[model samples]
Each structure stands twice: as C-alpha cells, then as structure tokens.
Target chain A: MKRFRVLDIVLGILGLLTLLWIWHLVTMLELIPRVFLPSPAATIAALEWGLVNGDLLPQTLATINRMIQGWLLASLVAIAVGSLIGVSAIARAYIQPTLEFLRPLPASAIIPVAISIFGLNSSMVLGVVVFGAVWPTLLGTIHGFAHVEPRLVEVSRLLQMSRWEFIYKIGLPNAVPDILAGMRLSLTVALILAVVGELLTAQEGLGTAVLHAARSYRAADLYAGILLLGLIGLVSNYGLAIADKRILAWKN
Target chain B: MAQNAAIELKDVSLSFGSNEILTGIDMSVEPGEFVCVIGASGSGKTTLLRMIAGLLPPTTGAVLLHGKAVRSPTRRVAVVFQDYGRALLPWRRAYANVSLPLEASGMPANQRPARIRQLLAKVGLANHEDKFPGQLSGGMQQRLQIARSLAQEPDTLLMDEPFGALDAMTRQTLQDEVLRLVAERKTTVFFVTHDIEEALYLGDRVVALDSNPGRVAYDIKVPLPRPRDQLTTREHPEFLRLRREMFEIMNKIHA
Candidate 1:
C-alpha cells in the first residue's frame, strides 16, 4: 500500500508537470491572452495574496458550516422518513407519488424562491443544499430496508428476536453499505449546491471570491478560487471514501 | 421412554393459498429419538419439520410440545436450515454464530464465552472458531450451524437437509458425527431428507410421506443396536431391510 501511494504521487507529479508544460507552450504561442488565461505562477500568487489580505479563510469556514448543518439535518430527516416508508407498504404507496413530484425539481431552480423568502442569507444557501442532498439519502434508505434478505429476516424471527432486535441486528447492518454510498453521493451534491447557493446570493465564500474576481477581470484570482473549490471537493470525496472503506472492511 | 415424548402433532395440516401441502400429519417423537422423515421433493417433509420447529403454522391442526400447542418458535426447538451459507450470518465469526442463540436467550454476558466454547468444541470446530462462515469450507460451515443450534440446548432439533449440500464423503462423516452428538445430548430430532439411504441410516423410525397433499405413507422402525458405526450399521440385516422397504414405498408414491 505504501509503495502504491508513492507511485500514485509520482504519477500525479508527472501529470501536473506535463499539463504545465503544455500551458506554457500555449501561452507563449499567444493562443489566449494573459488577462483571459493567467499562468499557474500568477494564479498561485493571487491565492497567496487572497489568503493574506482577504477574508478567504473566514468565508471558506462559513461555507463549510452551512454545508455541514444542511447536510446533517437533511440526512436525519431522510433516514427517519425513508425508514418509515420502507417498513410500511401503505405508507410507501401514499407518500411515493408526492416524493416523486418533489425529488426531480432541481435544487438550483429553488434558489430564486429561497432568496425571496430568506433575503440572500445563509438560510437561503442551506435551504438549497438540503433540497439537493436529501433525495439520494432518502432513496438509499428505502432501497436498503426494502431489499433485506427475507431468509435472514426469517432466521432472526425464528430466534424469537424482538422487532427492535431485528432492526438493529439484521436491518441496520445490512443497510450500512448502501446508506454510506448514498451519503457519499449526497455529500458531493451538497458541495455543488453550497457553491451554487453562494454564487447566486452570498456576499462571501469561495463562490463570491470567484464572482468578484470575474467582475474586476482578475483572471488569476478567479482561477485560484476555482482551484481551491476543486481541492475542497476532492478532499471531501476522498475522506468519505476512506470512511466507507473502514466501516465496511468486512466486505470484499 | 414414554414420558420422554418431546413433540406430538395431532392431525396437523398446512396449506398455502388453498393448496394443501401437508395433511392429516400425526406423529410423536420421544426425547432423544432420531426420527428421519423421507419423501420426494415438495412432499411437505420440510414443511412438517418447520411446523415442529414452530417456524410455520399448521393451517387447521396443532403442533404440541410437551402437551402444549406451539404457536411460535421457542428456544427449546431449534432448526438448522439446508443452506448453510445463508443460515449463518456472514459478518459474524463461527463462535459468534454459535453463541447467537445464547445471546438471544439473554443469558448473562459472563457465562456466554464458556457456553460458546463448549458448543464449538462439541461440534469439533474449536480450531475454526475465529473464522467467518465465508472463510470456512461447506462442511465446516454446516458444522458451525449445527453447533449454533445445539448452543440453544434445545429439547428438539429439526434439521432440513442439513448435510444435503456436502460432498458424499463429508455428508456421511457429518451424518455419523450428528448421530453421535444427538445420542449424547438425547435431543429429539426431526431430520428431513429426500434420500432414502440417509433416512434409514440415521433414523430410529423412518417416516415416509407421499406427494400431493403430503401424508405419512409408511413408518418403519429400525431395530439396529445402539452406538452403531457406519460400516457395521450398513451391513446390519435390519438396516438393509428398512432401506429396501423405504425405497419401495417411495417408488410406489411416485408411481
């Protein structure tokens, strides 16, 4: 594993170097203007300047806080409602059409309405993120619970396990992998919605930094902010993947 | 011996959506009696065993345990299903699977380890206790399932084709081991099988069932002596006679 990680890092460095070389060649050939497409060095310099002089760190923190709160609240509600629907056929039949009606409406489409209701605040950002993140988690919970092996359920019942015991022992354990996969997917969607929310209405955050740079024609700063957003997304996804591996180590 | 009748079924009948599976099933098993129920596929042998284990409800009649009707599965009656791979939980180690019944019984935590060890040792799986069912071979996994059922200290054991998935050699060996263990524990067994030879080999009394609304077609007693070995029991005159009789009964049922 250590050898593999080292090899991955080496390959990554080579890939980055190749990209930089191509960029240098393109810029020297005047394929794009310096104002339109800043070099990597210029972007780095802009990143350092933003980190030192602007409220970049604070805005990043604010974005993260809203994302976490929205994602967690949405997950809790999704699991509760999804599990209820999973166990009861009548409940599923009654609620499924309404959920279907609501799920497909894009979270981004709700931004204007949220801005009107919450007045361009964190609440508006949170509302959009929650709307985007909840559906995958809810569908995951429903699928997980609905597909529990009937034979295993019979075995548990034959053991004279209580309803609570059946849920904890057989139900929850079987559903963990599916639930985690949903969570991972929802987290990615939540991150996208967070940036979208900020870009649409917020006066702060990396999205705001990017928008400001664009308006002022600071191409380097815009590129740097976009890079930072990409890095955050990559880190979040990798972190969730590591967590999933650890929890489901028993599986192949 | 009469006082040791662990289970009794009085006109026990089972139907699924108007199709009668088992009808007019009356049988009594004494404590420690290894009674094997043999029939063709879909003959309701498994259903009868499930009813005895209280995993299935008899539609019209009742299954009695110690003179009381059994409404649901109780710890006193445990079943080992044919699918050993599916029977044991994959996430749990062999010892944990064996200990599941004890855990469900809510036995104090302190005593569980010792009980699990005892049962695992009994099933000759002491060395493989830490391994999961996936890690073990088919025979080893089935042994683990047997150990799990035995951990409940059940008065009656209902095994539905427990050795059916095993190779012929492993099946015969496990059959001998199961018989020896059953003899030691003196637990009443309702062993279901489609194999006439296996039924005759392990049973104190072999009950043959006919297909299509399965009913007991014949009951033959094995007069072979106790502590019988594989070779000696197969060579015994009574064993051969019983095997022939069961085969004829099955042949006629199919006809």
Candidate 2:
C-alpha cells in the first residue's frame, strides 16, 4: 500500500510536469499573446509580488469568508426545507412545482435582481451566493430523505419510536451521505457565485482583484489571481472529501 | 383471572379495497408461547404478523395484545423483519444498532453501554461491536437485528419470515439461536415463514394457513421435546409425522 501511494504521488508530479511543459511550449511558440496569458515564471513572480505588496491575502480571505457564510446559510435552509418536503407528501405536492421551476433558473441570472434590491454590498453578494448554492443541497437532501428503505421505516414503527426520535436517529443519518454529496456540489456553486458576485458587485474579493488586473492589462497578476482561486478550489474540494471519508467511515 | 395470552387475533380479516388478503385468522398465543405460522408464498402470513404487530389494522375483527385491541405498535412488542439489510441501520455500528431501542426508552446514558454489550454478546456479536451493518455478513446482520430486537426486552416478538432469506446452514443456526434466546426470556413469538420444517422445529404450535384469501388450515401442536437437536429432532417420529401432515396439507392447497 505504501508503494502504491508513492507511485500515485510520482504519477501526479509527472502529470503536473507534463501540463507545465505544455504551457511553456505554448508560450515559447507564441500561439497566444503574452498580453493575454503570462508565462509560468512570470505568473509565479507576480504571485510573490502580490503577496509581498498587494491585498492578495486580504481579498482571498474576504472571498472565502463570504463563501463560508453563504454556503452555511444555504446548507441550513436547504436541509430544513428539503427534509420538510421529503417527509410530507402534502408539502411535496404543493411545493414541488415551484422548486422545479426555480431550480432550473440559472443562479447567476438573479444577480441583477439581487443588486437592485440589496444594492452593491455584502448582503447582495451573499444573496446571490446563497441563491446559487442552495439547489444541489436541496435536491440531493430531498432525494435522500424520500428514499430511506421501507423496512427501516417499519423497524422504526416496530420500536414505537417517537417522531422526533425517528427523524433524529433514522431519517437524518440515512440522508447524510446524500447530504454530503449535495454539499460537495454546493461548494463548487458557492465558489463560482463568490467570484461572480464580487465581479458584479465591485467588491474587494479575489474575483474583483482578478478583474482589476485584467482591466489594467496586468496579465501576470490576472493569471496569479486565477491560479490562487484554482488552488483554493482544489484545497476545499479535498478538505470536503477528507471530511466525507471520516464522517462515512462506517460505509464500505 | 385474566387471559394473559400475549397476543390474540379475533377472526381477523384484511382486504385492500376488494382484494381480500386474509380472512378469519383467529388465534391466541399464550404468554411465552412460540407459535409459527407457515404457508405458501401468497398466504398473507406476513400480513397477519403485521396486524399483530399493529403495522396494519385488520379490515374486520381485531388484533389484541393481552386482551387489549392493538391500534399501533407498542413498547411491549418488537418485530424482526426478513430484510435484515433494510432493518438494521446502515450508518450505525453493531453496538449502536442494538442500543437504538434502549435509547428510545429514554434509558440513562451511563447505563446503556453494559446493556448494549450484553445484548450484542447474546446475539454472538460481542467482538464485532464497532463494525457497521454493511460490513457484517448476511447471517451476522440478521443476528444484529435479533440483538436490536432483544434490546427492547419486549413481552412479544413478531417475526416476519425472519429466516427465509438466509442460506440453509445460517437459517438453522439462527432458528436455534432464536429458540434459545426466546426460551431464556420467556418471550412470546409469532414467527411467520414459508418453510414448514422451520415452523415445526421452532414452534410449540404450528398454525398452517392456505393461500388465496389466506386463513388457518391446520393448527397442530408440536409434542416434540424442548432442547431439540437438529439431527435427533428431525429423526423424531413426532417431527416426521407432523412434517408429513403439514406437507399433505400444503400440497392440497397447491393442488
């Protein structure tokens, strides 16, 4: 197993090297303008410079804070509402058509409406982020709660378990795997909305920093900000994956 | 003077709209009695068990527990269903699954550990307390289900084809285990199964039902001695005679 892990690391480094080599080749050949895409060294230098001088860290932190706030809000509401609809047939029938209609509407499309109401502030950005981030979690949670095995329901009944006890012990645990999967999707949505919200709202976030760099033709800074965003995405995705593994250790 | 029978079905009849499932399933189980209901696939034996467990109400007549009509599942009763895969919570460890009923009873947190361990050990799963139900084998999962049910310490257990899905060897082992446990606790059991031999071996009395509007066709006592061995019990004259009689009745129903 240790050897296999070592092999995997080796292969991962090799894959990175291959991608970097491709980028180097593309720059050397001038297939794309240097103004449009900076070289790897130039991008790294700009990243170092920004860390040393600019508000790179602050902007990144701001974006992340907004993401956490919005993501948490979405998760709490979606889980609450999803479980409600999942358990009650009457609620599902009444609310399903509206959810179906709204789920398909692009989350980004609501930014203008949010901006008009909340007007270029954290609340507006948060509203957009929450709007975009909620669908995956809501849909996944509803599916999870609806599909708890019938026999388990019978077992709960046989135990003469109270409604609260049944939901807490059985319903919630059963929905967890699906709920986690939904959160994973919601994380991606949160990141996208965070960046989009910043760009639209003219907020002081990594997305705004990238927009600023690009507007001024600072290709290296633009690439550096974009790279940092990508890295954040990677780190968060892996973090959630590790958390999922730990939480669902009982599962095969 | 009270009847004190653990369960009584008073001419219980069930129908889904016009589709009659069971008709006149009249029976009474003495306290601590082991009664097995056996029949073919469409015999509604499971439906009868469900009625006694109060999962389904009889369309006519009533299912009573200790002379009181059963409206819903009560704390005094527990059910061990056939689908152990679905019955045991996939997210829970073996010990936690056994602790579920204890927790529901609002037992003190400090006292749960020993009780959970005791029940797990009773079902032969003491060493596997931390393993999840998905990791356990089919037989082991069934054992976990039994352990969970036993934790309730219910006066009556309603088993719906609890051993039907198991392989032959596992089925026999579980049958013996269930008998030993129930005997020790003096828990009244209403075991439903399609296997005639299983019914005879495990039951004090076998109530055989016929299909197509299911109703009791044969009610016979198993006079075979307790502490029955798989080999010697099968070899016993009474066991074979009862088996032959049940076989003929089942055959006639099929015909």
Candidate 3:
C-alpha cells in the first residue's frame, strides 16, 4: 500500500508534465492565437515578474485572507446550525426544506443582494463567499451527528449523560471525519466565491487582477493569475488532506 | 440495598406501533446476582436489556431499579454492547474512552488520570492505553469497552451479547475475566446471549425467552460451584444438564 502511494505521486507528476507539454505544443503550433492562449513560457515569465516586482504576491495574500475569513465564518455557523438540526427531529423537519431550497441557488446571483446589504466592499465579498461555502460543511455535520451508531447512543443513555455532555463527548468527536470532509469541499467553494466576489466588487485580489488583465488583453498576465489561483486551490486542498489524515489516523 | 431488588420488571410489554417486541415479561434480580437471558434471534432479548437500561420505555407495566420506577437512564447502571467496534469511540485512545463517564460526571481534571489508569488496568489494558479501538484486536476492543463501562463505577451492568462477536477462544478468555471481575466487585449483571452454554457458565440463573412477542419461558437457577473453571465447569454434570435443557428449549422455540 505504501509502495502504491509513492508510485501514485510519481504518476501524478508525470500526468502534470504531460499536460504542460500539450499546452506548450498548442501554443508553439499556434493552434489558438497567442493573444487568447498565452504560451507556457510567456505565462511562466508573467508569473515570475508578478512575484518579483509586481503586486501578485499581495494580491494572492489578500485573496487568501478573504477566502479564509469567509470559510471560517461559514464553518462556525454551519457546525452550530447543523448540530442543532442534527440532534432534533422537529428542527430538521421545519428547516431542512428551506436549506434544500437555498442549497443550489447560485452564489454569483447573490452578489447584488449582498452589495445592497454591505455596499460593494470587502464585507459584500465576504458575504457572498460565506453564502456559497456554507452548504457542504453544514450538510456533512448534520449527517455525521445524526448517524452516530445506535449502540453508542444506548451507551450514552445508560451513562445518563446530559445533552451538553453527550454532544461534547460523543456527538462532536463522532462527526469529525464527516465535518473535515465537508470543510475540504467548502474550501474549494470558498476559493471560487472569493475570486468571483473580488472580480465584481473591484477588490484587490486575483479575481480583480484576472478581470483587469482581460480588459487590457494582457493574456500572459491573465493566465498567470489563473495559474496562481489553481496552485492555491491545489495547495489548500493538500493541506486539508494532510490534516484529515492526521485526525483520522485511527480509522483504517 | 438488601431489601430492594437490584432490578425488577412487572408485566413489562413493548410494542412498536402494531408489532409487539416483548410482552408480559416479569422478573427480578437481586443485588450482586449474575443473571443471563438466552433466546433465539428476534427474541427481544436486546430490547429487554434496553428497557432495563431505560433506553426504551415499555408500553405497559414498569421497569424498576432499586424499588424506583425507571423512567429514564440511571447512572448506577452501565451498558456493554455486543458490537465493541461501534460501542467504543474510535477517535479516543483506551484511556480517554474510559475517561468518558468521569468527564461526563464532571470529575475534577486533576483527579481523572488516576481513575482512568486504574480502570484500564483492571481490564488488562494498561499497556494498550494509548491504542485506539480500531488499532486493537476484537478481544482487546471488547476489553476496552469493558474498561469504559467500569469507569462509570456502576452498581449494575447490562451487557447485551458482548462476547457474541468474538472467536471461541477469545470468548472463553473474556468469560473467565468477566467472572473474576464481577466476583471481585460484586456487581449485579444482566447478561444477554443466544449461546446456551455461555449462559450456563456465567449466570447464577438462566432465563430463557420465547420469541414472537418475547416472554420468559424458563427461569432456572444454576447450582454450579463458584470460581468456575472454564474446562471442568463445562464438563460438570449440572452444567451439562442445564446447557442441554437450554439448548432444547431454544430449539423448540425455533420450531
């Protein structure tokens, strides 16, 4: 199994190299106009320049800060509300339909509503991100807390545990695997919403950078921003995967 | 303590909508008594144990603990479930799993470590205190569950086929260990199992249940001697006779 994992990483790197080669070939062959699809080399040059003497690093940091703050807010609210709904049948009956209705509504569509509330600033961007990123974690928490093994429930009951004690000792710990999985998914949603919020609100982040670069026809710079966004997504997902592994080490 | 029964059920009946699970069940257990209930599958043996533990309320009659009607779970009774894998907290190490009851009862943080350690040691899990339930073998996991139950410091234990999932060899070892521990602590035990001989080996009295709305069919006392030897006790004339009787009754119920 360990051997497979090592081999798996090597295979992943190979697959990435293959994709890069294809992109390079496409640009060199002029399969698509260079102005529309920048060469790999041109994109890399733009990325280097942005990091060395441009506002790319700060832009990247701003986007990350906004994304993280929004994700954290969503997660705290999700877990609190999810736990409440998960533990009670009556609450679930009344609230689940409303959640189902809101779950699939587009976050981008909510931008105008949020702008009206928070006035087209960072808070509006934060609001949009929170709205989009809250669902997966919320649903995951509800499922996890609700589906705790019946035998454990019996044990808890026999111990005569208080409601607070039951949640702290059993409900929360039991839901860790599901909650983390939901958080991982929500992180992706958060990054997407953060970029969208930044673009529309004219916030100083990668989304605005990408949007401004497109208007000026700086294809390489636009591609560079896109590349950085992809990297951020990959890295954040990897970090969470490591955390899930550490937390669920006891799970086979 | 001497005057009141440790556990009592008077005409206890339970129904889920239209289907009856248990009906007209009446029994009593003295303090420190080891009573085992035996039945085939769907005999509501587990349901009966749940009622005694106050996890399920009977549709008719009452479950009494120490002369008090049990409407809710009492801290004085600890439950050990058959599926040790599910019974235990997978995230917690053995020490922390045993600390659950103590923590729930608000034991002082500074004082919990010693009690947790002692409980783990009592269940022969001292060396594996840091191991999670998933890391332990079947027997070890069940031992961890026992340690967790013991942490409650309960006067009575309600065990639902706890050894039903173990291999035969592990089952025998745990049976002996349980007998030793229960004897030492003088804890009243209500043990449920489908295994006839296991019921005979551990119980001071064996109560057999009939299925299709479970009711007590037989409640026979075991006249076997104390400090039972797993090998010799199985071969004992009275043990063999009682085991045969239980087997016959169980088979008849299936028929």
Using DockQ as the measure, the top candidate is 2
Off by over 4 Å in 1: A1-25, A52-54, A112-119, A201-203, B1-4
lDDT of 1 by residue, A1-252 (tens): 889999997998899789888887777776999898888888888888888897777777776777778888788887877777876667777888998998899888888888898888788888889889999889888777787777787788778988777666766667778778888888878878888888877557888878888999999889888878877777888889899987876565
A175: Cα error in model 2, Å: 1.2
Evaluated with TM-score, which candidate comes out highest?
2
List DockQ for all candidates: 0.56, 0.84, 0.75
With a 3 Å backbone cut-off (N, CA, C), the pairs that clash in candidate 2 are none
> Positional deviation of B57 in candidate 3, in angstroms?
1.7
Per-prediction TM-score: 0.90, 0.96, 0.95
Pairs of residues at least 3 apart in sequence or in different chains that clash in candidate 1: none
In the range B65-127, model 1's lDDT, one tens digit per residue, is 988898888888888989988878777788888877887889998999998988889888889
lDDT-better candidate, 1 vs 2 = 2
Off by over 4 Å in 2: A1-13
Pairwise DockQ winner, candidates 1 and 2: 2
lDDT of each: 0.84, 0.90, 0.91
DockQ, model 3, C-alpha based: 0.75
Across residues A1-252, which tens digit of lDDT does each residue of candidate 2 receive? 679989987998899889888998898889999999889889999999898898898999999999989999999999988887877667777888998999988988898899899998989999998998899899887888788888888888877777777677887888899999999999989989999999987899999999999999999999999999988888899899989999999886
